[model samples]
Target: MKKLMLFTVIVAISIATKAQQYYDVTKYGAKKDSSTLATKSIAAAIAAASKAGGGTVYFPAGKYLTGPIHLKSNITILIDAGAELHFSDNFDHYLPMVESRYEGVDVFSFSPLFYAYKAENIAIKGRGLINGHGKKWWDYALTFYKNQTARNKYQLLFDSANKNIVLPDDATQMQRGFLRPPFIQPLYCKNVLIEGITITNSPFWTVNPEFCENVTVTGVTINNPKSPNTDGINPSSCRYVHISDCHISVGDDCITIKSGKDVPGRTKAFPAENITITNCTMLSGHGGVVIGSEMSGDVKKVTISNCVFDGTDRGIRIKTTRGRGGVVEDIRVDNIVMKNIRDQAIVLDMEYSKTKPEPVSERTPKFRNIRFSNITAYTKKAMYINGLDEMPVSEISLHDVVFEAETGIVIRNVQDIELRHVRVNTKTGPAVSAEKSSRILIDALSTVKPLMDAPLIRLTDVKEALLTNHWLFDGSHKFADIKGAATSNILLHNNILKGATVTTAADVPTGTVQL
Candidate 1:
C-alpha cells in the first residue's frame, strides 16, 4: 500500500511539473509585432519544448507572424485568447518542398502552415486565431486557370509526377510546383487534437489530416470565404475520427471525408472508417458534409448527426467517378437541417468526372448501405442519385425527410431503395421519380403542394416497386405515370389517391401495375 501511494504521488508530481513547463516563443526571440517574421523563433521554442521531453509551447496575447510551424510528438501549442498566429504569404518561405500529397496524389509540395510528419499525441488548443493569409496563393492559382499555357504546364508536371518522374527540388509555384499546401496537415499521425481555435484564410483545405488515426477536432471555427479550395476539416485516409461543435463557413466543402485517390490510393489500400461528425453548423460552402471524389481507397462506417447547413451549394454529397475504384458504404446521417441550399439538398453521384462507359471492374466505384433520417431542407433541388449504368448504387434508405424545393427527388440507376415518411413540396416535376431502378419501397410519401400537370410519382424501367400508404392532396392531377416495357410488378396498396388518375404509357405491358 505504501509503495502504490508513493508511485501515485510521483506520477501526479511528474504531471504537474510537465504542466508548469512552458516554452514561451518570446524567450526564443519571437517578436510580438506582426510585421516581423518570427518563424525561426517559433521553431526554436518548439524545438526547446521537444528537447525538454514534451511541453506546451505557449503564445501570449499578441500577434506573431511566422512561416510553417513544424510540430513534434507529445507537443501542445497553446495560443492565448488574444494571440494570433499569422502565417506568412511569402511563397519562398515555404521553401525547397517537402514530402506531401496534393489532391490525393503523392507529390513533394510546399509544407503546410502547421504540419507534423509521423507524429503522435500532438495537440493545438486554446481560444485564439490562425490566419493563413492565402490571398496571394489564391491569386497565383487563378492565373493558371485563366492562362491555358500555365494550366497545361501544371498538368504536364502533375502527369509526369504520376509516372514516377521526380520534380525539381527548387521548382517554384509558377513552374513545376503548382499545388497549394493545406493549412494544418498532420501526415501519418496518431492521437491528434485540434480545439477551440478560429482558423481563417487558409491556402487550401484547412485542418486536413492525412493518414492519421484517433483524431478529434471540436469547438473549432473556420471561416475562409471566397478562398479557393479552402475546405474546412478534411480527414483523408484516416480512421477513428470525431468532429463536433464546429462552425464552418468556407469556400469549399465544410467537412469532407476521403481515402486517397486512383491507382496510388488503391495501392495504399487504407480505408477511412469509423468517423463521426455531429453538432456542426455550416455556412457558405460548397457542401455541408461531403465524402470523396478522392475515395479510391474506400470509405465506410461514417455517421453525421445533428448538423445544420445554411447557404451552402449542397447539403450532403457523396461523389466519385468511374476511374475511382472503391466502395462507400455504411453511412448514416440523421437530424440534419439545411436552408438556402443552392444545389440539390442531397446527392450521390458516381459520375463526378465523366468518362466513357466501361465494364464493371475494380475501376467502377460502388455506393451502398447509406441511410438518412429526420432531414429537413429548403433548396433548389431536393435529392438526386445518379449511379453508373453498369454498376448502380444500391441499398439506400431514407426516413422522415421533408424537402421544399423547386424540383423533387430523382433516382436513376439504383436498386433496393426504401423511403418512409418522405415529403416533398416542389414547384414542378413529380414528387418522386425513378428510372433504371428496382426493388423500391416508398411508404407514406406525400407532397404538400403537388404540380397539377405532373404525376406524383413516375417510374421508368423499374421493377418490383411498392408504393404504399401515400396521402395525395386535393390538387393532385395524376397519381402515377408508369412507362417502359421493362417495368413490371408495381404494386400500389392502401393509398388515398384523392381522385387522381393513374396513367401508363403505351410501351408498358398489361398487368404491370396492380391497384
Candidate 2:
C-alpha cells in the first residue's frame, strides 16, 4: 500500500506539471490578422509542444490563416473561444501530396486541413471555429468539370487509383481531380477527442476519422451549406466511436458510417463496428444518419437513439450495392423523431447503384437483424426496403412506429419481418405493401382515413403472413388485397373493419384465412 500510494502521488505530480506547459502560437511568430499566412508559426508551436513531451498548443482569440496543420501524438490544439483557424484557399499551399483516402479510395493528394497519421491521444477541443475557405475549392471544381483537359487528367488519376498504382511524379494527374481535401482527418489514430468546436464551409467531409479507434465526438456543431460533398461526421472503418449532443446541418448526409468501397475496400476488409449516436439534431441533409454507398468492409453493432431529424432528405438510410462484399447487421435504433423528411423515413436499399441482378458471390451485400422502435416520422414515404432478388434482406423488426406520409411502406425481397403497434396515415397507396417476401407478422396496426380504392394492406408474391388486431376507420378502402401466383397462407383475424372488403386473386380462393 505504501508503494502504491507513492506511485499515485508521482503520477499526479507529473500530470500537474504537464498541465502548466502551454505553447502559444503568437509566441511562435503567428500573426493575429487573417491576411498574413501563419502556417509555419502554427506548425512551430505544435512541434514545440510535441518536443516538450506533449502539451497544449494554444491559439488565442484571432483569425489565424494557415495551410495544412500536421498533428502529433499526445498533443492538443486548443482554439480558444472567438478564435478561428481559417484555411488558405490556395491549392498550392497544400502541396507536397500526402498519403490519404479520398471517397473511400486511397490516394496521394493534398493534405486535409488538420491531418494526423498513426497519432495517439490527440484532441481538438474548445469553443472555436475551423473554417475551410470552400468557395475557391468549389469554384475550381466547377471549372475542372467543364474543361476536357481537366477531365482527361482526372481520368488518369482515377485509372491509377483503381490499378493501385501511385504516380507521385505526374503533376498533371496529381492536380487533376478537384477532389478537395477533408476538413479534419486523423487516419489510423487512437484515443481521439473532438469536442465543442464549430466547423463551417468544409471543402469535403468535415470530421472524418478513418481507420481509427476509441474516438469520441461530442458537443460539436457543423454548418456547411452550398458546399458539395460536405458530410458532417463520417467515421469510416473505425471502431468504438461515440457521437452525442451534436447539431449538424450540411449539404450531404449529416452523419454517415462507412468502411470502404469496392475492390480496395474488400481487400483491406476492415469492419466498422461498435458505434453509438445519441441526442443529436440533424437538419437539411441527404439523410440524418446513413450507412454506405461505400460499405464494402461490413458495418455492425450500431445503435442510435434520442435523435431528431428535421428537414432532411431521409431520416435513416442504409444503402449498399453489388461489388461490395459486406454484411450490415445488428443495428438498433429507437426514440427518433423526424419532421419534413423529403424521402422515406426509414429505408434499407441493397441496390443503391447496381441496376441489374448479378450472381451472388463474395461481392453480394447482405443486411440482416436490424430493429427500429419508438419512431415517429412525418415524411413523403413511411418506409422502403428494397433488397436484391438473389439474396433477400432478412430478420427486420419495427415496434411502436407512427408515420404520417403521402405514401406508405413498400417492401420487396425481404423475409422474417415483424411490425407491432405500428400506425401509418397515408394520403395515397396501401398502408403496407409487400412483394416477394415471406414470414411477416403485423400485429396491432392501424391506419388513419385510408383511400377509397387503395387497400389498407396489399400483398403480392408473399407467403406465411399474419395480420391481426388492426382498425380501419370510416371512408376506408378494402381491408386486404392479396394477389400474385406465389401468394399463399395469409391469416387476417380479429380486425375491426368498417366498409371494407377482402379481395384476392382467382387462385387465392378466400385468401383471408382464419386460424
Candidate 3:
C-alpha cells in the first residue's frame, strides 16, 4: 500500500510540472521585426496558453510592435531580457471600447494598451521594455484641448450617448471617447503583480489598476516625456496595494491615489485603503505623492515611507475641492527627502477648484488625522494648509521636519494641529503664519536666520494655541504677533524668545496672550 501511494504522488507531481507550459510568441507566427503587426500572433499565443489551463506567454529577445494585448486569468506575460514590446501609435487599433474609468468617470472608451477585465492571478513580469508610442495621441489631445469646436462635438456625442440617443453609424471612436485610455489597466482584477518592467512614452496614466485587490508593483521604471496626463502609477479605488522600488519621471504626479469623482464616486463608495508605498524616487513631476483632486469615495489608511523627490512641483499633496466630497484620514508619511520643489513641500488644500461656499454636507470635503515625520526638504515654499470654513482640516501632526525654503508655512482654517521639532530656514516671511485655527500645539519650533521685520510666529483669529519650547532666534522683531478679536487662550511657556515682544492688535482683548 505504501509503494502504491508513493507512485501516485510521483505521478501527480509529474503531471503538474508538465502542465506549467511556456507558449512563446515567436513559435505562434509572431515575427521578430518591429515593422510587422504582431497583435494577432500574440493574441493567438495568449489564447493557446489560456486554453491549456494557463501558462507564461513569453516574448524573447527582440522588438515586436503590436496593438492592445488583452490578458486573461492565470496568465503571466514574461517579456525576457532584450525584448521590447512597442505598442502602435494608431488610435484605431484600440477599437471596440472596453469598460474603463477615465479620470474618475466610468466610460466605455478605448481599450488600454494592456487590459484585463475581471481576471485573477494575472501578472506582467520579467526584465523587458514596453513602450507606448504616444506622440500622435498627445498631438490629437492637444488639438482637442485647443479647439472648442472639437470639444463641443465630443461633448455632444458623449452627452447624447449617456442619454441613449444614438444616430450616426459613421461616428468614430474618437467622437465617442472623451479621455485617453491608460497604458496599463486591470479592471476588477485580483492578485495582480507587475514587476521588473520598464515602461516609457505612455499615452495616459501609466500602471493604473482600478478596483483591484492585493496588487504588487515593484522594480518598475516609468519614464515618460513631459506630455499631458502621463501619470506614473495610479491605483484608483484599490485595496491592499504595495508599491516599492519604483523610479518615476512623468508629466503629471509621480504617484496619485484616487477613489472616484463626485456623484458617481460617492455612489460606488469604494474607498482606497491599506496602501503602502516605499523606496521610490520621483523626478520632474507635478507632485511627488498626491492623494486627490478626485476623491469622493473616502481614502484612508495609506502609509508612505522612504521616498525621495527631486524637481517636483510639490512633495506631499492632498488636494480636493468643495464638490469632491471625500474624507481623507489616517495617512502617515515618514523618512522623506525632497529637493528643488517649485511649490510648497507639503500642502493640504480644500479649495483646488473655485466655488462659492456651500452648506456643510457631502459637498464639503474633509481632511483629518494625517501625520508627517522625519522629513527634510529644500523648496520654494515650506508648507501650506488651507481648509474649508465649514469643515476645517483637523488632527494634522508633524514631527522632526526641516525645510529650507524661500517662504514659510501658511495655515488657514485648521484645528487640532501639533508641530514638534520643526525647523524652517526661510528667506522671507514669518517662519509660521496661522489664521482661523484652534487647538494648536507648537513644541521646539525654531528658525535659521530669522527675518528682521517679521515675527517668528504670527496668529490671527486663532484660539486655544499653546506655544511652548520654541527656541526663538534674535533678529529685529517680535516673537509672536497676535491679532483678531476671536483670539483667546494663547499661552507661551518655556521659550527662549530673547526679549522679543509678543504684540497684539487693538481688537484683541487684553490678557489674550499669557506668558
Candidate 4:
C-alpha cells in the first residue's frame, strides 16, 4: 500500500510538470493585431519550447499573421479556441526550396506552410483555425497558365519528371512559377497527431503526410473552396495511418492515398500499407475516398468503412494508368452511404491517362482482389470499371450493395467478378452490363423499379458466367439480354421475374441457356 501511494504521487507530479511546460506566444511579444507580422515572435516561442526539452507552444486568443513555421522534434503547437494563424501571401516566406513532392514526383520546391522533415513525436492540436491566404497564389498560377512561355516551361518540367530527369535548380524552375505547396506537410516523421483544427483556403492539398508512420488525423475540419488541387487529407507513402471523425469538404478528393509515381515511385519501393479510414463525412469533393492516380509504388491492405459522402463528384474512386507499374490489391470498402454524386458512385479505371500499352514491362499497372460490400448510393451513374486489355482486373467482389442512379454498372476487361445479393436501380439503363469480361457470377440481383428498354442484366463478349436468382421488381423490360459472338457457356436459371423474358442476338451461341 505504501509503494502504491508513492507511485501515485510520482505520477501526479509528472502530470503537473507537463502541464506547467507551456510557453505562451504573448510572452514572446506576439500581439493580437492581425496587421502586424508575428512570424518571428511565433518562431521564438517554438524555439523556447524546444530549448526547454520539448514543450507546448500555446497561442492565446489572437489573429496571428505568420509565414512558414518549421516544426521540430518533440514539440506541440496548441492554438487556443479563439486563436487564428493566418498565413502570409508573400511567396518569399517559403523560399530556399526543400525536398518535397509536387503531384507524385519528387522535386526541390517551395516548402509547405507548416513543414516538418524527419521529426519525431510532434502534434498540432487545439480548436483553432489555420487559414492559408491563398488568393494571391491562385491568381499567380492562373497567370502562369495563361502565359505561353510559362505553360510550355511547366509542361517541360512534367515531361522531364516522367523520364526521371531532374531540373536545374529552384531559381530556374521558379521562372515558370507553377509549383504550389501544401498547407501542412510532415515528411518522414513518426508519431504525428493533428487534431481539432479547422483548416481553410489552402493553396494546394490541405494536410498531406508523406513517408510518415503512426499518423492519426482525427476531428479535423477541412473547408477549402472548389479550387484546384485542394485535397483534404492525403496520405502518401505512409504506414499505420488512422483517419477518423474528419469532416472534409474540399475541391479535390477528400482523402486520397498515394505512393509516388511511375519510375521514381518504383525506385523508392515504399508501398502505402495498413491504412484505415472510418466514421468520416465528406462533402463537395472530387472523390469521397480515393486511391491514386499516383500509386506507382503500390497500395495494399486499405480499409474504408462507415463513411458518408454527400454531394461529391465520385464516391469511391481508384485510378491508375500505364507507366504506373504498380499493383493495387487487397482493398476492402464496406458500409458506405453516398448521395448527390455527380459521376459514378464507384469507379476503378486502370486507363487513367489513356497511355497505350507498351511491351509488358515495369510500367504496366495491375489491380486485383478488391472487394466492396454493404454500400448504398444514389447518384447519376452507378459504377464504372474499365480495365486494360493487356492486364485485366481480377477477383473483384461485391455483396449486399445497393445503387440507384441514372445509369447502371458497366464492366470491361475484368475477370473473376462476383456480385452476390446486389441491388442496382437505374432509371434509364441496364442494371448490370459486362463486355470483354469472363468468369462473372451474378446472384440475387434486383432493381429498384422496372425499366422498359433496359434489361435487368446484359452480357456481351463474356464467357463462363452464371446469372440466377434475380428479383426484378417491376419487370418492365426483358430479364436478360445476351449478345455478341464470343459470349458462351452462360447459364440463366431459376429467376423470380413473373413476366420477364430473355432476348438473344443471332450471334449468341446455343450453349448459352435460358430456363
- Which has the greatest lDDT? 1
Cα lDDT of model 3 by residue, 1-515, tens digit: 99999999999998887577789999998888887999999999999999988889999999999999999999999999999999998877887667888777667677899999999999999999999998788888778655654545445545554553222212353254566779999999999999999999998999999999999999999999999999999999999999999999999999999998887678778989999999999998999999998788889999999999999999999999987788999999999999999999999999997788889987679999999999999999999999998889999999999999999899999999999999988898888899999999989888868777888889999999999997776663678899999999999999888878788899998998899
Estimate the lDDT of model 4.
0.88
lDDT of each: 0.90, 0.89, 0.90, 0.88
- 82-184 in candidate 1: lDDT tens per residue? 9999999998788656677766766767789999999999999999999999999999888755565544544454445445622222234324447888999
Q: Give a tens-digit lDDT track for model 2, residues 1-515.
A: 99999999999999898777789899999888887899999899989889888889999999999999999999999999989999998887886667788767677677899999999999999999999988888777767666554355434554454455332212353345547899999999999999999999998899999999999999999999866789999999999999999999998999999988877678778989999999999998999999997788889999999999999999999998877878999999999999999999999999887567889888889999999999999999999999999989999999999999999999999999999999998999898999999999999877876788788889998988999888778877688888888887888888888768888877664634553
Ranking by TM-score: 3, 1, 2, 4
Q: Decide which is better by TM-score, 1 or 3.
A: 3
Best candidate, TM-score-wise?
A: 3
Better of 1 and 3 by lDDT: 1
User: Against the true structure, what is every candidate's RMSD?
Assistant: 3.7, 3.9, 3.6, 3.8
Give model 2's clash tally.
Answer: 0
- The runs of at least 3 residues in candidate 4 whose Cα sits more than 4 Å from the true structure, single-residue gaps closed, are 1-20, 148-177
Q: Which regions of candidate 3 are displaced past 4 Å?
A: 1-13, 145-176, 474-476
Local accuracy of candidate 4 as per-residue lDDT tens digits, 103-157: 6667767779998999999999999999998878877776765556435544455
Span of ten consecutive residues with least summed lDDT in model 3: 165-174
List TM-score per model, in order. Answer: 0.93, 0.93, 0.94, 0.92
- Per model, how many backbone clashes are there? 0, 0, 0, 0
- Model 3 compared with the native: what TM-score? 0.94
* Alpha-carbon deviation at 96 in model 4, angstroms: 1.5
lDDT agreement of model 1 with the native: 0.90
